[model samples]
Target chain A: MQTVSIDVGDDGTLSAVLRGELDFTQAARIVAAMEAAIDDCRPDSVRVDLAEVTFLDSSGIGALVRAMKAADQVNASFVVERPTLVVFDQLNTAGLVDVFGLRRA
Target chain B: MIPETDSGYLQRLAELEARVDQARLSPEILSERAAGLLAGRIGCRIDEAHAHLRLLAGQQNTSVASVAATVIGALEIRRSTSLRQVRHSVEEALRATDQEPDQPVRVSAPDASYSWLDVVQQMLNALPGKHIVVVPVRGDDGRITDYECVAVSPGMRDLSGRTGPQLIGMAISTAYPDIVGGPVWRAWADSLTDGHPRSVEPFTYVHIDNGDASEHLLTVRVRPVGPGLLNSWVMHDEQTRLAERIDQTERLGNLGYGEWDLITDTTVWSDGLYRIYERDPADGPLPRAESEALGLPEDEPLRRQAAEEFGRGETIDLTTRALINGKVKHLRAVIDTVRDAEGRPRKVYGIIQDVTARETSRRKLAEVERQLHEHQQDLAAEHRLAAQLQHIVLPIPETPVDLPGLRAAVRYLPAEQASRIGGDWFHAALAGDGSVVLAVGDVAGHGVQAAATMAQLRHTMAALTMTTTSQPAELLAHLNRLLLALGVSTAPATAVIVRWEPATHACTWSQAGHPPPLHARAGVAVELPRPAGPLLGGLAHAEYGTNSLDLAAGDILLLYTDGLVEHRERTLSEGTAPVADLMSRVTAERRDYPLDVLLAGLQRANPDDDTCLLAVRRTDCGNGHD
Candidate 1:
């Protein structure tokens, strides 16, 4: 389901738009795409957009954490944006909202 | 048109006349003349007359030319004026030809001996298999020098590719000099000399082509016919190879063949047939009645159909079951009959194929399919039972109930699919300390196990609230510890628990990996800030904290499981936005019995998970000291 699409901004920020059900099935693919984008762009900042994500299970949460870690390893600032209420609730339940820098946009 | 008086022309005429006289005595010319004369006398075709002469020679076991000579001699005697004399002379000629081995009988018609070769050639032309007639050419010392081929079967060809008329007059010693002293040549000479049949055992005959030699194993049989020997050659390896091929095919195909001669009442079964029936070859073929009795009773109709088709002179190809040695086997029989000239069955031939392996596997696959269907049915039944148990364990109240300082209404929505009944549940009741205890919990997973865990957790919370302190944080901690102590079989769960004190107008709540409750007031709704607490059964020493919020009359608080705001097609916030907006609108409307209305208005975002919702509203009737 078109798991991730990446765009590099002029300010050295890499924005990756994630789509479809972000469960165990798409978790590995999402992480790999994010890592590849981070390695290729070496951006100053990274933003993962969960605006189109329809579902998030525990595995999806793990993938987001892994992506954030990948960004950290590259000395980049990572932010998660535009999570639906259900996804936000899930992040909050896992106590990852603050850790992922989840914010409304 | 030379002048008749020319000496050269006269000498040419005398030479031609002598040549004609010599040709008349030749065997071919003599046989032709005799056949012509016989045809004219009998008023029949010359070919029929020649055939008749050959047939008579065969009956008498003599040469056609000898028979023709006897006929000519009788006719010449008849020309001398007496039919009785002709008959006597014919009888005498036959007797002398039979008795005299070395004597000259009737001037020893030496040329007449070879006249039948053409008739023999005609016979060979009409034959089906490989055959050739070769006449012995005598040397000056009277010993057989060599044999010259006079007739060849139409289908017979030498290694040189010469066949039929091309092989005529070819000396065997020149064409196949390798066999001049071989077993076949010796057999031919011996058969000619003794006028008896002889056969040579299989021997290798090698032919050289362009200095490359190829070897063939052949058998030769010769029978003396007139002044020649009729030789039949067989490729010894081909016959043996053909029989082996048939045997191998039968074995590999799991098939057997049987033939029954109706006229003789004799039955013959191939070796494969004996193997198929698992009978010793020494036992002979099974009797027809016994073999028929082996057919399973269930296949009687198929047998009847086959019999009917057979009676109509139709070939029967049928598959039926047989019980042999107590094991059922599938047999496919293809039966046909050899019919007589009048269309009556003279012989019956049948090929029986053992197809038991194929049939057995087919039946097994069908059985497996039936079993899979029944397994799915059992799973469906289990789902129904699990759903029923879920309803009985966590029954939702139809109307809101009055808690210490609030009106609480609970609604339970099952998953859209019947099999997805889950562990979502809610509890809203008064504790022993005059405080109201409320809780909404969701056990991970579905089916009966989830329902059972939900029941256990609900009962444990109820018991804890009645006997222990009415504190949200303490109660959550206790529930978490209880989940951990219940062992790995108990799935991890999320729950939000709250204790409401009517005297203080204080609502203290805590959650374990659960969403904070939504608080709605005058035209606004917001999710309460959640305290630091991990989900139940996550750690050995997990701590929970409480969040307290002062409530006034007409304030509505909604607590629900993730199913209410979880969907596969959208993010969590998207799913919850509408619910939050609805709560704000409901509070703004200031409708009476807003708790009931809010619960009724809410819809689950994900139909694949069960949703449990608890809505409570602060009422003016409660003994609030705010």
Candidate 2:
């Protein structure tokens, strides 16, 4: 599955929709793609949607942290939304529930 | 047919007698004249005609002078026919002369047949070695005195570099005085006397040229042909040189050749074949049955297939395994046959090549690949076992339990991926001081190493709560120092610890890079503000601050590791908002088991990280009795 699909919103917010297993295998790719999209578009805000993400490991968590750091470097606010219950649980376990701006779908 | 009475007839007869004397003096001249006439009649070269005359004289066992007379006579008798028919008539006359021993034109004189000598010389020139033909010279008593060289092969160079016609008609005794009664001379004499063949044993011949004598080992074979003995000599060194070349070629190609003759019931193997089979040449070629026995039993089918192809008259090329000297070797054999008119094999020939090195390396590569695949499988199995061990060490309680001042429930969720089992752990117990101590922690990363670190942290926490103070801030500070002391090998971990006193309903909590615990009162829930503290193992001498909150009756406090709320696509606050809302709604319901319901309502967010949840609710009854 495609690791992350990036779309530029009308409001200039870059939304990266991550899908499938987002473990160590896809984490690096997801982080690189998100970073590139943020660097290229220089969006005002970055929104990462985890609605389609079936799995996320610690490495995946690290990837999200890196992406957020990328957006912060560009002065763009990073927001994460539309997380499945299991995915939300993982975010919560990593103590990133509030840090990533996760919202239940 | 001339008139005897004519005065010129006497002079003509005298001239004819002189002409006969000249012919006797030079038999070669008479033979050359006859060869020239035959060449003109046959439209061939003079040498070809000369060779033909020599062949005729040798076959007829007669003298060249007599054969020349016969040829001249035949041509004269056919002079009346057309010139084109002259060749045909001459052939017919020769054939008639052959069949009729008493033919009028036939000659049986024992004179020198120079034409026959020329034919033998031509054959010797085509042959590889040195050769010479000599006729015996008889004395008055009819005993052989010496031998005269009539012809010599072109390669028969003496010490002085003389050969062929230069040495012809030279007596052996005059040319090589030492050879008068040598082994070769004896062989020549023996062959001439018995009209049979004889061979001299190898002997050293020393040639003196310009006072420099060089010795050569040579063997000579003498065979009588008509009145002359044909002597063929083999130089030992020359034979060895040719044999050495064959040996080098076979060794370089790792090949050997063998031949089997059915008619002779014998098998011949080249020197290379003996080396390939690791057998001594003195043992001769391996017997058919013994050689077949050397083939590996597993290759019997291949042999059968080859035999079937051979039966169909097809050249059989097959590679099969052979066990030689207790080691297996790959042998590629290409076999064919010499067939007779009936299409049956009269002889079999084959070449065998050793291909063991190539085959062995191919097998070794395949084996290495198989070993690599198996190693990957073993690694996967090890991951599974490590994950299983983590769960065994920290078994979760099936139901909530009543602690010192509140009822608490804990849930431990392992990662969905077996190999991703993280170090998420929880500890809740009543301390010796009677305060309820609760803690939740998650180590970074997953797999066996993370589980080991998690066990160490949890055990240390349990021991500290029992022996040391249960102050939340002090406990986190101690844990941080412990992680720092564990060195760089231990991944940083986040944890939140809480101590609640039932006497005052005062709750104090401290965290190390962990999320703030949720507090719910009268159906309203909010995240408690956290103090500054770095994750454990991040920095040495790091400090943790504690926050105190007074809980009223029916207040719920929830503490969880990040796996319960953290996700790749969401913020911690965003993920926790829903859980806080759920806690408020569930608390408002006034359920008898709010902690159980709240713990059950919360789901782990990430499949790759484990979660630990510890929920505690203050009882409305005094003394914290449920």
Best by DockQ: 1
- On residues B411-483, what C-alpha lDDT tens digit does candidate 1 reach at each position? 9989888767788889888887888888998876677877888888898888888898779888878887888
Tell me the lDDT of candidate 2: 0.76
Against the true structure, candidate 1 has what lDDT?
0.77
DockQ of each: 0.15, 0.05
- For every candidate in turn, the CA RMSD to the true structure comes to 19.6, 22.7
Q: What are the per-residue Cα lDDT tens digits for candidate 1 across A47-104?
A: 9899998678644665676677678768898888998776776877865565568653
lDDT of each: 0.77, 0.76
Best prediction by lDDT: 1
Ten residues in sequence with the least summed lDDT for candidate 2 chain B: B16-25
Question: Could you tell me which 10 consecutive residues in candidate 1 chain B have the lowest summed lDDT?
Answer: B15-24
Candidate 2 positional error at B512, Å:
1.3
Per-candidate TM-score against the hidden true structure: 0.60, 0.47
Per-residue lDDT of candidate 2, residues B75-153 (tens digit): 5444555765766756755764576645332122224374356556645654567888889899999998998998888
